[model samples]
Structure formats: C-alpha cells, structure tokens
Target: MTIAGSDSGGGAGIQADLRTFAFHCVHGASVLTCITAQNTQGVTRVDAMSPEAVTAQFEAVMIDMRVGAIKTGMLLNQEIIKTVAKKLVAFGCGNVVVDPVMVSRAGAQLLDDDAVKTIREQLIPLAAITTPNRYEAQILADMEIHTLEDMQTAAQKIYKLGARSVLVKGGGFTNELKGIDVWFDGDRLEVLQTEVIDTPHTHGTGCTLSAAIAANLALGKPHFQAVQDAKNYVTEALKYSLAIGQGQGPVGHFYPLLNRG
Candidate 1:
C-alpha cells in the first residue's frame, strides 16, 4: 500500500510510488492524503485531504484489499500522522515502511515542524523500517550529520527511539562522491553505496526507494535483502532517468519494463 499525496506532475509522491511498485512486479494500492499542484520546477500549491477522508480511504483499501506490506509518505500534519498510525495498529499491519518525507527536492516544507515530533514519537516506533534522508536524519535525531560516521551514529540514535531498523540515505550530500545509504538493525550496520549519477532527474527518489522496499517485502524477501534490492532498483532508475519538466525531472521508474519491451 502507498499512502501519500498525489503529484499532478506524476513524477513524485503517490505517482512515483505506484510506478516503482509496478516496476517491481507487485500490485500497488494507495491512500492519498493530499494533492499537490507541482512539476519538475517545484510545488506551487497543496490541498490537504481531511482526516476523515483519509481514514475512509484507508478503510476502503483495508477492508477489500489483501495488502502484504504498507508504505507511507508525505503525511503533512500531525493529525494525518496520528490517524494513519492508529489505523496501522488497529488493522494489525506488518512490513510497514515509513519514509519520513519532511521536505521536497525544491526545498518546500512538506511536513510541518509540529508534525515531526508526532511522527518520531507516534508513528516511527511502529514501523518495520524507517527510511530518512540526511536532512531528515538530522531533524529526527536532533543532531548534525556531516559524515558517514555521523550517519552511523544517527542511525543508532534513531533505533533507540523505537524503530526496528533504520536506513539513513545520503542523497542530499553536496560533495562529488558516491551516494551511500546506511542501514542499522541495532546489532548490525551495512552501508549500501552506489555511484551517484549527476543528473537533475531525481525528483521522487525517496518515495521510490521506500515503495520498492515495500514491494520486495510483500514478495517475502528479508529486510536486508529487500533494502539491497530496492537500492539497486533506484540506482538503475536514476541511471536511465528521463528529462521531463524544466527543473528536476523524474527517474525512469519503468526502466525494467522498458528493458523487457
């Protein structure tokens, strides 16, 4: 299940998550919490769906669909976060992937300052895995993360906060080095590194990665294996990204399908 907002540009958010799930050969389901008037350039406007509506969608999906795993993204406010968290626990869902989407690639704040505390306190502890980018890691852990060592420390700190596993993504780094995503499960830590492709078509990378992980989990892969496979999928998608709008475009989410074709 992909619980996120709709991206009118079809490059990020729910659109990208669904595309990533399809690429991974998993059935995709969504519960949209908001809608964004956005493009490759940036988000122009946002319309939040009412909490009642969000709950209705969740009920509709859960009652009819047999979801094996769930992924959440872009829940803008504390109300929405609390609502979703309650439903997850009520429904007894497993294999939950939480992508703490706090801000957009264009630097627009997607999550409110007040919502961060709610997410960290209420929602994160219930997740099977929580994926946070460097900036998000800093916010969630309340620290400065500038290096790989810092990422390791932050991952551990976050684990102590209640997450079963943590993946600290290093995509926001300004240095000209390979991208490294660190994963920690309290007892073990692994760095999944990939050559960073210098490209502007990476609009929905975080959403895509989390969705890919959900898809793999639904297919019954182990947590570490699912993360590794998702990382590889995102790497290929970025490598063959398509140039769309005037600003940062989107990765080639259909790369595998296109290759098959």
Candidate 2:
C-alpha cells in the first residue's frame, strides 16, 4: 500500500506509486494525506488532510486488507507524520519503505524543520529501507555530498538514524556520477549505478524508484537485490520518459505495456 499525497497531474506521489505497483503485478492500495494542484511546471496549491482523516484511511485499510509491504511519500506535516508512525507501530506493520521527501533535487526545502525532525526521530527508525535523494540525504546526514565517497559516508551516517538500510541517490550529480547511488546497511556499503538516460523528463523518478523497491519486497526479493532491481527498472523507465508538459515530464511507468503495442 502507498500512503502519499495526490498529484492531480498524475506524474508523482500516489499516481506514480500505484502505477509502479501495478507494473510489478502487485495490487495497489492508497491512503491520501493531501492533494496538490501541480503539473510539470510546479505545484501551485496544496491542501493537507487532517490527522483524523489520515488515521481513518489508515485504519480502514489495515483492518481488512493483508498488506504485503508499505511505502510512504509526501507526508505533509508533523502531526500526520506522528500519526502514521504511531499507527504503523500499533499494527506491527513491517517491510516499510520510507522515501524522505524533505528536499527536491533543485535544493528546495519541501518539509519544515520540525517535520523533518519528526521523520528523523519517528518514521525512519521504522523503515526497512529509507531512500533519500542527494539533497534529502544531506539534510538527514548533515553533510554535503560532492563525490561518491561522500555519498557512501552520508549513507552510513543515515543508517545510524535507525533505518535497516539507507540508499543515498546521486541523481543530482553531473557527468560520471549521474545515476549512481550509495547503499549502506549496518554491515555492507556499496555503490549502485546504471547508464544515465539523457532527458529532461525525469519527474517522479524518486517516487517511482522507492515504490519499485516496495513492490519488489512484496514479491519477496531480498533487500540489496531489491534496490538493484529497482535501479534497473527506473533506468528503463527513464528510457521511455514522457514529454507531455511544458516543463519536466515523468518516467514511463507502463513501459512494458507500451512496448507490447
């Protein structure tokens, strides 16, 4: 299941997550925490759900369905983040994947300082794996990432924050380091790479990657292998990126289906 905000443009958040899940032949469920009026250009308006509404949606899903894995995205505020962390503990939910949506690739701050603290203290410790982009990793790890070694160090530091594993994505890197990612479990530290697809239509890449990881976990892939497979999946999806909007577009979630036709 994906707990995230809604993107009316259908490029990221709940829309991209569900598409990625279905691409893996997994049933997708959702609990929306907010709604955003956004397109490739950018977000114009955001309306967050109350904590009570989020809780109601969470309980309704957890009570009846047998969820295999859970992926969280765009948790709007501190109250909602707290509510989600508490409920996940209450229900003993495992295989949780947390995509820390605190910073954008362009260095924009998405979440406030207090909400970031709540995620660091509460949500991350519960994550089976936490995926943070370069800027987000810097915030969580409290260091700048310039080289691959820096990414490794950031991953190790973030691993200490209680996630079973940390993946520091290097999508913001230029030249040879582009598409490289550093993975650090408590024991192993490794770099993951794929051939960079040169395109401006790379919206939703982070959300798609993390959701693919959760879907693979639901399919019983081991943790390290899951990240490897997801990296490969996103690489291919980027090859078919959509050039729909005036600005950045999205990766093709249904590339296989598109290829079939």
Among all candidates shown, the one with the greatest TM-score: 2
Which digits, one per residue and each the tens of the lDDT, describe model 2 over residues 1-261?
999999989999999999999999999999999999999999999999999999999999999999999999999899999999999999998999999999988889999999999999999999999999999999899998888888999999999999999999999877578899999999999988888899999999999999999999999999999999999999999999999989899999989898889
What are the per-model numbers of colliding residue pairs?
Answer: 0, 0
lDDT of 1 by residue, 22-100 (tens): 8788899999999999998878999999999999999999999899999999998899999999999999988999998
The alpha-carbon deviation from the true structure for residue 118 of candidate 2, after best TM-score superposition, in angstroms, is 0.5
**How many backbone clashes are present in model 1?**
0
Superposition-based RMSD of candidate 1 using all C-alpha atoms, in angstroms: 1.3
Instruction: Please give the range of 10 consecutive residues that has the lowest summed lDDT in model 1.
Output: 103-112
For model 2, the superposed segments whose C-alpha errors exceed 4 Å read none
List the RMSD of every prediction in angstroms: 1.3, 0.9
Model 1 stretches astray by more than 4 angstroms: 105-109, 176-178
* Residue 16 miss distance in model 2 (angstroms): 0.3
